[model samples]
Target chain A: MAVDTRKCVGCSDCVVACQTENSVPIGFCRDWVVEVTDGTYPTLELELRSERCNHCDNSPCVRCCPTGASHYDKGGIVVVTHNKCIGCGACIASCPYDARYAHPDGYVDKCTFCLHRVEKGLLPSCVATCPTKCMYFGDLNDPKSPVSIMLKNRKYKTLIPEAGTKPQLYFLI
Target chain B: MREELIVSGRMNPFIDPHLNIWHWQIPLYLFLGGLAAGILFFAALFYLRGKENEYRAAVKIAPMIVPIILIIGLFALFLDLKHKAYFWHLYTVIRLQSPMSWGAWTLMIITPLSFIWAALHIKEVFPKWDWKYQWLKDIETFFQKYKKVIAWLMAIYSVILGVYTGILFSAFNARPLWNTSILGPLFLVSGLSTGTATAILFSKNHEERKTFARIDLLLIAIELFLIVHMFMGFLASTQVQIDAANLFLGGPYTAPFWMLVVAMGLIFPAVLEALELIKFRIPVYIPAILVLFGGIMLRFILAYAGQMSRWLY
Candidate 1:
């Protein structure tokens, strides 16, 4: 997933869309916007970035799961097997991005990257409903993919690379 | 603290960055697991070294609490599980990378071995109590016949269980406070120290009491050093690690950590145990009780502080 931070307006429409699409609880969210403010008052610079599960290559949540409940699918999307989850919260504690939570129904829940839609060759709900068209979802390995084309010229960065999580989410600044 | 001088790539507002998924039961399980591990290790050690008679309270009574305490710890773990019915899922596969997996396998092996260790000693301690039951007598005979092998196995399992408790926390890399390598040895020494104090509390012989006090004093001193090294490790790492170090130095976690774990738990007990080590005949139970309380509080602080730590970036 690649995001064009230049087009984001901190509107949080995608957040609401995700909640409705995934049936996320009232106080919970699968995705959200992080607004960063910089510079002095007279010359303040505001930046809004959409954030969610990175589906990290070195996902700690999957590594820490005792029952193999938190796992990666064929598309490399990290997901939880609700039935096998003992709800020990080990995966929740191990997630560096704070992307997981103990759902009220006795399972660790996280953003699935809209796996149901992706499996059907459809974009994620947040990517599809985004009014600014800032979000881009495609195989990074495919040279012709929009995400690959965007990364070729745009200056991009991932959050906390020093964590060694190797997050897949990229922000084009 | 000046807001007007904010720079680029500066502070950002992140909503709901913390997850309060774990509760008191997790910490309680860790404490009991460590304590049980300590008791079993020391008991097996005393028996192997031919000091069983000299340290009867430790060798005989310590293993006796192994099965009982671990059962309660497993019960606490069961209660903490959201899908308690699916507890068997933990045994379905083995993920070498997962500390929880290692712990589950370790507990499964140790729990039964611990019971066998206790049963071996039961005949020696209470010869007449189980003689009425034929099956109990036969089981005791079987364990007694293989007592030496059981002692060696218990000794090994006990150490694994003790270190596993600390590894379980340290394995969570997201929690910077628990990510250090020293936590393993720190917890092992604490378990040993607390186990020695418990043995001292139960010892009727002055020599046994004095022996345990001396050992506990040494363990406390080592625990102090390991804690200092833990903070130093944190300070020498990344910004996230430095923030985690501050949790103990001057952050909101400092009060409980210092008051319960350091002062009441290590310092006071160390001083009292030190006095007793020098043949000053102080009240052993007071310091013993304090050590146990402090040990439990240490787990509480570790669990809570670990949750507080995050990738602030």
Candidate 2:
């Protein structure tokens, strides 16, 4: 999905939206903004990128897990089976994108792109609530979807694209 | 919007935050397994020397250590588990591509074999059958024939346990400091050095002690050489790798890495082992304590060094 951070005014409505919609437990978020500022006071350029589970084509978290508790679910979502997890934290450590966390309960937790919501004909909580519309969700393979269309038209970058997770998310330049 | 939040949920911030599995825990299995191996190998040398007291002591204690180290490792692992009670599910790792899966499988195999092997060594510990029961003698003979075979297998398994931790560290390609190919050999050597020191320090006989002393001296010298080689490997690499190496040599984590590994681990053990060879005088338990301390330090340094990411790239 294409994320035009320029449109984002830094309001975290999207963050909270993701929360209530998916019932994400307190003290964690499935998607958020990363802000970077450069140059002196007068010349400062501030930029932000909203990020989530890249759901990469080739994921490291999948490889490092010993218990097979971490894997790709339907629609290419990187889902962690909390019940099956031994909480070894192998996946959390291996993820270069810093996408996963070993929750206090010891199971790996992260954004599943609101798979439950998607199954219910609703946009991801984050995408639906974005005040600035900075987050987008859609099948990367469908060339005609709004996300696929925007991805083709805009110059954007994915986090650590060189790592070859072939992330589905994008930061619109 | 006036954001009243003291801290954003978006950020994962904890002081010395446990980075999931990368928390401060130094995969204690390496140290414990090495300790077991150290004890068992020393026991073997005692057997070779025919020092019955040392052999009996070494054999008895060494076998006991196999389970202790395994249990210690299990405890460390469970402590790290998010679902501590569901820890038994670790045995269901059917995947071959995952090291955690392989480690779980190895642990299952190693624990049982260790119990059987240790059980075989303790003849008196086994339940005494009536003298008239003729079949029990065959069972005794069977354990004797396979004890050496089991010992060899145990040693190999021990090596796998030791080396596998290093391999686990290196698998984190994003963490370049841990990505060195030298890590596997480095860990294996560290295990041998630590284990041998443990064996020598704990032996019950003078000659039994001396044999492991020579081994201790040899291993310490080798480890010293290996330390140099590891540094050289880092120095020969990219700017990113060099900065990562500095985290160990004379950089931020240098104090723990050097003081613990070089001073407490390598130098002290070497000096103590040398006294046995030259002055022919050595303290009984002091050497063992120092050596085990050193081994622990070595692993502590290795682990600490690995976690310090240069991010120079």
Candidate 3:
């Protein structure tokens, strides 16, 4: 996933789209927007971007899950098997992104990159519904994919790279 | 330079304020698990050293409550699970790198062994404890025959259980307050101190109480040293880790952690125990109760504060 920070306007259309699409319980979210303001008044800078599970290449959540409920699917997307999860919250604590939440139905819930839609040959609801088209989703493994091309053409950074989870989400600067 | 992050559409209850999924249940469970492990470890150690007759409280009396403590601790863990029905999944596979997996398996093995170990000594504690069923009698006899072997196993598993209670939290690399190797030893020593305090409280003999007080004092010393070392490690590490150290230094957790856990729990009890050791008059129950209080407080502070410590703003 690639988020063009310059293009995102903090509209939160994607957040609503995700909630309506995924049936995420009210008061909880799998994805959200963050507006970062940096520097002094005259030289202040603002960056708005949507954030969700990074689906890290070396995900600590999957490694720390006691029941193997958290595991990587094809394309390195992290998914949690609801039935297998003991809802221990080990994965929740292990996530540096703080991307996971305990569902009211008693299981850990997080972004799956809309795997259900992806399997059906569609973009994640958040990406598809973005008003500004700032969020890009595609196979990072495929060099020819739009997300890969965007990464190659732009300066990009992953959040908290020092955490060493090798996060897959990229923010195009 | 100033920076501010205003996040919208970020209302996940626990994560929004801080990581708060683990609450009282986890800390309570850890304290109980550590206490049970401490009691079991001391019981096995004293028995193996052929001092069971001298340390009857440690070997017999204290262990008699282990089964109950463990069951309560397991219940606390079970309650903390969101999907309580699927807890059986914890046993279906083993992930060696996952400390929670190790903990689940350790609890499984040790819980049953604790019952058996306690059951084996029941007859000694209560001479009238007759096995009404023939199968029960046979099981007791079988355990008696291999009591020493069980003691050895319990000793090893108890250490694992004790250290594991702490390792479970420390395993989360994301939480800076808990991401340290010292937590394992710190928790183990604290468990031993609390366990010895319990034994002292139960012992009717002055000599037995004196022996446990001395051991408890030493364990408290080691615990304080490890805690100081942990703070130094945190302070000397990355900015995030230094931020974690500040939680106890002067952050939100300072007073409770310093007053309740360190001063009231470890230091005050150590002083009382020391005074008792030096022939000063002090009630055995005072320090014992204080140590036990401190043990649980330590877990509560760490669990809560660890959740609050994170790399991301």
Off by more than 4 A, model 1: B1-17
Cα lDDT tens digits, model 3, A64-171, are 999999999979999999999999999999999999999999999999999999999999999999988998889988999989999999999999999999999999
lDDT of 1 by residue, B1-313 (tens): 1222211111111224355777798889988988888788888899899999999989997678878889999999999988788889999999899999989999999999988877777767776756677898788887788888988998998898889889999988888889987888888888888788778877899989888888888888899899988988889999999999998889989899989999999999889888877778788899999999989999998888888889843
User: What tens-digit string does per-residue lDDT give for candidate 3 at B146-248?
Assistant: 9999999999999999999999988888999999999999999999888998899889989889999989988999999999999999999999999999998
TM-score of each: 0.95, 0.86, 0.98
Predictions' DockQ, in order: 0.49, 0.43, 0.79
DockQ of 3: 0.79
The 10-residue segment of model 3 chain A with minimum total lDDT is: A32-41
Clashing residue pairs, candidate 3? Answer: none
- Model 3 residue A122 distance off true place after TM-score fit, in angstroms: 1.2
lDDT of 2 by residue, B1-313 (tens): 1121212245553212324244445457667766665555545455545564655556555565677777887677767677676677777766777777787777777777667666565554345624355675576677678766766666667667667766777776555577677777767777777666555554566776677677777877877887788789889986657887888767888888778778877887688778767866668567667767777777766666665563311
TM-score evaluated only on chain B, model 3? 0.98
| lDDT (CA) per prediction | 0.85, 0.69, 0.93
Query: Could you give candidate 1's per-residue lDDT for residues A99-161 as a string of tens digits?
Result: 777677778788998999998999999999999999999888898988899999899999887
Candidate number with greatest DockQ = 3
Q: What tier of docking accuracy does candidate 2 attain?
A: acceptable
Error of 3 at B253 (Å): 1.0
